[model samples]
Target: MRRLVARDERWPLREAFVIARGAKRQAHVVVVEITDGVHHAHGEAVPYARYGEDVPGVLAQIDALRPAIEAGADREALLRLAPPGAARNAIDCALWDLEAKQAGVRAWDLVGRPPPSPVKTCYTLSRAAPAAMAKAATANARRPMLKLKIAGADDLAAVEAVRAAAPRTRLIVDANESLSFEDLQRLAPELVRLDVQMLEQPLPVGEDAVLQGYESPIPLGADESLHTRADLEACAARYTCVNVKLDKAGGLTEALALAQDVRARGLDLMVGCMVGTSLAMAPAMMLTPGARFVDLDGPLLLARDREPGLSILGSMIEPPPAGLWG
Candidate 1:
């Protein structure tokens, strides 16, 4: 006797969110709410087209699990039930929420993690021409850290623009797997000169095998190329860090494990989020303490966020409010 509710939601972004891949004006997400009659909890997931996930496909995956979930299947059962992706992420988080409500405890406590404290988050400068990107960077100039999306060689001018606008702000350039080794090498000097703290996923996953012996001036991080704990071994040798998004690792359960594995291998951890609501960012906050960088600014990009959202005072994300899912 559990109840499961699943649906799709669309939150309009304040403006088009541009990445190396493309542009999006809205965040399309799948939401799940599970209840044990007396108490309930929610989870949210963005059906990333990059992962070949669409709203219908993700919902169908959850529908397939309804019988088992209603029969009291736990989060571990979900890992085997659904392949790791947006679908699994939504359900896994929902289960965590439900369990927390049932035990009358916080989600972090249920997961055996420390309660979150406010952390500095990366404000993203979407992919744009140098001037536009620079203007955006200047607008967020006060932010402690900024993540610049690099689409190609033209982004050199964009980086220069941002640097000119915000001289003191720390920078992380996420190429989103758009650069070849030569492209990466050509930009390395400029990136270091700009004092860019991190270079993220400049090369595509399959093609990144060349990174093993490359001498990179700036520390590089993996986003698209790193997934579960399984990716830690190979990525540790190639990347100095890995960006852990709950969508990629399936949920908080796997993300915690991935973070532990990344640390065990001496790789830096970055907790990132796809554009969604605060519900998505709240669980990710659990990983923030150990992360080298935090990119949980999804709600800030949206035109409107759900009530009881995580408070954002400037670029810092505070812990989740009680009314919001843990």
Candidate 2:
């Protein structure tokens, strides 16, 4: 019989991670482990309040599914057993890790993908005043790319400050569903002129219809607005790109499928992550092969990461070793 274990953990951030939504000083994550007497594997996920999930609720959800999981429920079985959220994400990824260990092969082999390669990731600067943002941008100016978290007001000044501080660094901005249609319209032209490469989730989630016929100079990528394949059709009509995160898609199983659908629709792909540990970012690395932007900088923001984490060299993230999860 298989054994299942799930628990909540908190990892402190190097500094507060502020976004348009709010700020967090720690990442609250739920980790799941499955073992079949001889072999064991693990998975991790961050419970996002925006998705109506909290650590206690996620832990309870996982506990409720313990019976089925220990009885050998596979990844496909999990889709019907649990709704998409942080709970299913932890369980599904643990199953993948367990399967990879049992077979003595990498998880990519099971998914029929080539071995993952080191990918360049964007360093993120939290929402702050223009001067504060400029200071942070100056510190990371040598990074290949920097993603700025912006709120509607004073955002132009913040981006302009960042651009001036890091003239050679590529820039992308995320509004975290905090912007209105008018805010996007007013900011798009200036962002383009500042050489900003992309703008993510400017409008609120359900209100994405506001972008139906509108065209902007900078490409808009859907983050909070797009989750799994079910959300693709509506988002494709409104946005030029999609951000795929394992926790948002439920797990790697669904994220891989969503990545393909994003490409099939001719929308650019960006694999992103919540502010968790490297364990949470490891599985997401699988989706970065052809992605236009990779934002799996979860560990970089942490004060300390789980040992045996993915190797990050400067702005590049190396693939996770089997010991870490696959």
Candidate 3:
């Protein structure tokens, strides 16, 4: 016999996490658990408002599937059952965790992906004033890579401030789709000069089509615009890389497929995350192999994370402990 459960959780952030979109003081997550009397496993997902997902809706989606999942529905069946989003992510990952625990093997082993090793992740500097961002960057100068959240036309000012404060640290800039195509073109040369390694979603999803065939100095990656494989072909023409957040891909099952599709398009991979505990990052960690960038520092931003969390020191992230999830 099988049992399934889903519930909502809220974790306070150590400080407000500010991005181009806005600010979040807490990470709202939906957790799913599955068991067969003894062997048990769990998965966690952050419901993102940008993707039109909310806690109640995600929980309802998971709740609706309990009967099917308990009746022996598998991961493959889950892809067809739920559209790509947080709800499916929770259930699919929980299924993987349950299967791995039942089989006495790691989730990576089951997926045919290589065993996970320690990965270098990017520390995010929240959207802030130029002086404040520089101060924050200086405080975190030990980090190897810093992902700056940029918002306005004055992004170059903020980037310059951060770069000057943390000269040795590599940088990735995420505009969160706030820049217009003209502004992006105007800023590309300056970003390269600043030695920024990448730019994430500089323009809004609807406005991103303008980036197609526009040569850029720094690599441009798709985030909100690139979800399932359905967005692959179009994204290929617009950006050089794609950010795969498990919440957007649904779960590990489809994330693997999406990464495969990304490679087919000759785009670089970046495994990112929505703010949550280590339970969320554990599964996302499985996708970091050979990825150009890993942005799994969500747990680092929280005031407190669950026990057995991923060990993160600055930008260096150790793989998730077995007891966490996968």
In model 1, the Cα lDDT at residue 130 comes to: 88
Clashes of each: 0, 0, 2
Compose the digit string of candidate 2's lDDT tens values, residues 90-208. 99999999999999899999978889999999999999999999999999999999999998845899999999999999999999988888888888999999999999999998888
What are the per-residue Cα lDDT tens digits for candidate 1 across 109-169? 8857778989989999899988898889889999999999988866899999999999999
- Give all TM-scores, in the order shown: 0.98, 0.99, 0.98
Rank by TM-score, highest first. 2, 1, 3
For residue 108, give model 3's deviation from the true position in Å. 1.3
Best by lDDT: 2
Summing lDDT over every window of 10 consecutive residues in candidate 2, give the lowest-scoring window.
150-159
**Runs off by more than 4 Å, candidate 1:** none
- What are the clashing pairs of model 1? none
Q: Which is superior by lDDT, 1 or 2?
A: 2
lDDT of each: 0.91, 0.93, 0.91
